[model samples]
Target: MKTSTELALSLNPAKPRCTQPRRWLAAIAVLSVSWPVLVWADCVDTRKATAAEVEFHGRAMAALVAALPPVPVGGKLQNKDSVTTLGQQCRGVTGDFNLEATRFYELNFRKAIVSVAINVRQLRTDAAGLSESYGVASPNRSAALRVNNVVWTVSGSDSPLRQALVDAMDRTRLQGWVDKPLPSVAESEALASQAVPAAVAVPATGAPASNASTVQTAPQPAVAPEPLREAVDAVNKLRGLFGR
Candidate 1:
């Protein structure tokens, strides 16, 4: 007697035998398309920030706070009037913005000059409330504050991120801040003139002492490094969850 497979094939020879391979190909195609999404999802995993990143954030936050108009003596920072005023001031500097549930503003500070996402949230509720608000207090708290978005690519003075960074650098008055505006042509020429040293007259071997022209070398000024890119797309992705 023939084996079951052989008997079935003999009975229905017209049936396609390539179905298994076709199914496998379809599965592989799907997996190829889905692989990137899976990788991006994994980007949400909590990761430690580098020292430079932490320091940069501290400075950036200070710059932002400094840019805000001072709160009136009795006014709270989170109050409606204060929020509105702060939002206006921030927008004047940074362009359109999203005020996040009266807590912090959601800003897309990603540009060629700076890259950051200001969506990290803090746990302000009790443990029981936190658990109810977000399941599993430990992981939820970390997840709420994780940075996961890819940095956006933007440039020019029209960019809110670039403008915000420039304003920040201006406020700090630090020399060689990466986000500082490039000097205008006239300004650069003036600086070049100032940098160049005066040439002195020198004596030649057989001639009187005052006759020869001497060359003077001028050193080039150090250029600031370009702003660095970092993970900054996470805020746009999780706006709903974080708006609270």
Candidate 2:
């Protein structure tokens, strides 16, 4: 007699390949969908994330900012729409600023700059020679530099969050991120390291004073006496007579 298992197999109709792939393949496809894709652990609630979470987000934002196109010389807003769009896209991307933060940042995230920070950020440029002086058909200057308005906003404000934002700007050279092409971290660090000193104060009474003590007057060349002048003229007259 045929084994009970063999008899059962023979009685059961085989499943068609067209209807389904091998069991392993079907299992894999099912598993792939069920498995959660890897993402930032704190992407859901950054405020609760530790310092590591903040750093992760900062880096993500930096990379996002770096990938942006560079600002042309003299500064222009070429990607105003792109920025708004990117803002929209970033809401879905983890580690970057939340685009949704726009709605909630001012509402609940003021203690930190998560939402309003990048939202308030806008590309700014101070283009020179744009007037009639530049001529009727001049090409856009290549010297355009794009800077983050957020930096200036924080700079002027007394917000406790200013330093944190400033630190991000320095590390990422984010001030130029959107308008300028990406630069190496080393390049940015070097630029930030060479900080410009504060301007010297001008006198309240008037214009600033020059460092006169450092100035040096050129020495005057030796001059012949008045008698020497007359003597030279007389010599010239004597030479004329000799020629005669």
lDDT scores for all predictions? 0.34, 0.36
* lDDT, candidate 1, 86-187, per-residue tens: 211111122112211112112333222222222223322442211112122232211222221111111334433333333332222222322343333354
**Strongest candidate by lDDT:** 2
What's the TM-score of every candidate structure?
0.20, 0.23
> Candidate 2 lDDT, tens digit per residue, 74-169?
223312322222221122233233311111011112222222123222332332211011112112211122212222222223332333333333
User: Model 1, poorest ten-residue lDDT window?
Assistant: 87-96
Deviation of model 2 at 16, angstroms: 80
Clashes of each: 1, 13
Q: Any runs in candidate 1 off by more than 4 Å, and if so which?
A: 1-45, 73-178, 181-244
Model 1 clashing residue pairs (backbone): 149-234
- Misplaced by over 4 Å in model 2 are 1-93, 96-151, 154-176, 179-181, 206-244
